[model samples]
Target: MTEERVVGLLERLLQAKVGHDVARLIEKRLGRKLEPFDIWYDGFKARSGLDERRLDAMVRERFPTTDAFQQNLPAILEALGFDRDTARFLAAHIEVDPARGAGHAWGPVMRGGKAHLRTRVPKGGMDYKGFNIAMHELGHTVEQVFSLYRVENTLMAGVPNNAFTEGFAFVFQARDLDVLGAGGADPERDACRTLDAFWSAREIAGVALVDIGVWHWMLEHPDASPAQLREAAVKIATDVWNRHFAPFMGVKDSPILAIYSHMISYPLYLSHYPLGFIVAYQVEDYFRSHPLAENMERMCRQGRLTPDLWMKRAVGSPVSADPMIRGAERAVKSLLKH
Candidate 1:
């Protein structure tokens, strides 16, 4: 059968099983219809005149210091309510053996272990992207450590899935600036941050949609050939691209979505990107007012606590638009105002 025909059949099967909610959610958030070629296109270029180079630089300059990270841990753990023993345990996990190459996380809990953090910098990255990734990974490590040892059981340890963890990870990832001592409530920089947040939210939200739709398609079309699955993925991605980001790029049929290796290797991980962004916002808000002592270890212990319970107990709310979309919008608006 032709690729299009096979995809159509797959979509039918997916809709039958997982329902069309994923597609509908994508359309609702994006506020438009998706074409088959708009998926992977970067949507941020149109706003802020920012480029990846600058962002990368920002990440590199920050997040390499044990002292800087230490200063922030108390507040971070306080927000999560971690204790001393747990803090030490988590600190040990993130002790930076240095032998472990860059960008490595130990154990499922990202915090209980240290990340190798392979920075592009010859002397070591001192830029935003690298720092962002490091911090992002740190957030993952924090959540990982908390969930694994802090929480009750392995079964109840982290959030629901990769998407939930990703959300928590993004909370720290977005804080690269604050961690680096460069970001804050400054008007101009805050506007930049706002723009970046919106752009990222849209981008990841789209990716999550694609991830959900593709999986739903896969689950339904068990008999679908790999080639057919690839085709379906492309179409969905393209459709997503045009719907949310087409106007900014002024281009269509971008093969960008094809690059999401996560879709192929980590089933259901795509949802985490957008979910992580949302969850991160909520967590950040929690830290804005709340403060923790040297209890990194205590926070690390609360792993996998269902999204609902974790959010309610951790921040006193259900996981919803407040942390994801609404919270983001508020942060962006505040940033823009300054």
Candidate 2:
């Protein structure tokens, strides 16, 4: 079958898996009654502005599916401005595994000298969610690579916590299209980014609220059953959904909370997404004015830095919601202004 046909098939599969509500909402927005095939086809093609042939080529070129990630690691590292020795050190330690459900970075102070990565995402997972996961893993890998090879000592060679690293990962993940030289900046691409940014920011912000509430609930009801946890999660999720998303959806349900996979594995990771969004945009803005290489290396080298210190050093200010909120607002305004 042709690549477009494959992409279409994947999209249909995705829509089928996600549920009718999401599919219908997307269909309406796209100005048609949506079919499963349209989910992947329309959504992917819309954001990327690339047909199957080009998208496949781009993906293959960038996401190395084998041991050869070693070869690419140096270029990526060097692009972010690592020194030659540091780049080589990172290249030797970049491990690509096929064992993970998605992707991950296990590195920086483990007994092993190298960082291991797993890239076993489900098929058709190449959509925005999958890509975001991929880029976030890339962010983690880069941090691992930098801290292990470039930092002064093992003690300091890593991020202080998962959220801070996730913040960096979020920053890199947002740049996936830009890094790949895909469609961006023009009217079509800007519209795509705006829609995605809106969708992502809204979805994640709600999840963050749910996560916070769930944690507090968990703390209070330490012996809460899985069912109780799930029930409480649904209530919290519905609350956030009603406040933020009900206007857009015209419906409310707690099943939405059940859909967040991270809620099961990483209880607190949801909060990091929104925080990462803020940090990513802040870093993105900084990279706009400063050279990507010099600034990024300096930022990475300051391993395990406090969030406040890291933000000040990298973005010339403390971490705040202003960057993401303002950037998103401006993106919307620009689209409306046009």
Candidate 3:
């Protein structure tokens, strides 16, 4: 998609209903004006209601080490919607290990090889944070296994791009609390989730714009030095931050957006995250009446279809953020009334 089209699509979340309502909800929850650090806000998350220490204890009790998590993959997959046979088959094709750093997934190229999952497991045990990251990585592992082994042609073995994979990661990560049996369904909980998705998507949209802006700047000033590029990056970040985030946050000219290493290392990859979040929301909504594992198998096997066609085939609609915005609008209004 073109940068303008992507930007325009994401900016819808920043309008009167979704973004502003999230700010209001945050203000009410915190009983204070938004701080710069509020960009990492967690109050919208259901787990925010639970003590972190308790969650850590629970996770450690369940997964005292990486091996424990690896062994339980079948059960975990079953809990997430896969039947026992499918869960066991998926688990059989995946291996897990401890990570010194953050969690990640690596898939093998050939059919006989396995998908590898890595997550941090401390001397003490795997805690809530590590488990959450592991769940995210598990999504990637599952997608890899399906797209690689299940597809007819190994050459067409992945989704549209990294954004689609990230979307899959988000799908599993969003269910971590539920997988632990620590989450329940209710109107407010559902509302909070809707708001959470909107806030997070809106949060990344500005950073994506800043990334796009800096790329355009670099192209126009091809001969610029590192110092000049850095300065231009800061200016572009400030412009994006002011236009998108400052008003809602009541914080002005924050250069936090400019500091992401993705600008230097991955360059232009930040846009994938917001788009991924949009894709995740759409997928989650599609699962309301549809069975996830059935559709997941059906969709992941579609191989290299374009994202629009892939989404339309899988969910009966093209990938877009309108469903999330509408849900967030309904959620915020309902919560406000209550």
- Candidate with best lDDT: 3
Ranking by lDDT: 3, 2, 1
TM-score-sorted candidate list, best first: 3, 2, 1
Q: Compose the digit string of candidate 2's lDDT tens values, residues 119-209.
A: 6534433344445466577678767777656667767777655656776676566566665566455764554453454345445666666
For 177-215, candidate 1 gives per-residue lDDT tens digits of 554444556554543443445445556666666787788
Query: What does candidate 1 score on TM?
Result: 0.63
| Two-way lDDT contest, 1 vs 3, winner | 3
The per-prediction CA RMSD against the true structure, in angstroms, equals: 8.7, 9.9, 1.6
What's the distance in Å from true for residue 91, model 2?
A: 2.1
Worst 10-residue lDDT window, candidate 2: 9-18
lDDT of 3: 0.86
Clashes of each: 64, 3, 0
| Preferred candidate (TM-score higher): 2 or 3 | 3
Alpha carbon lDDT of residue 259, candidate 2?
Answer: 59
Whole-model alpha-carbon lDDT for candidate 2: 0.59
lDDT of 1 at 310: 63
**TM-score (all chains, Cα) for each model:** 0.63, 0.73, 0.95
* Model 3 TM-score, all chains together: 0.95
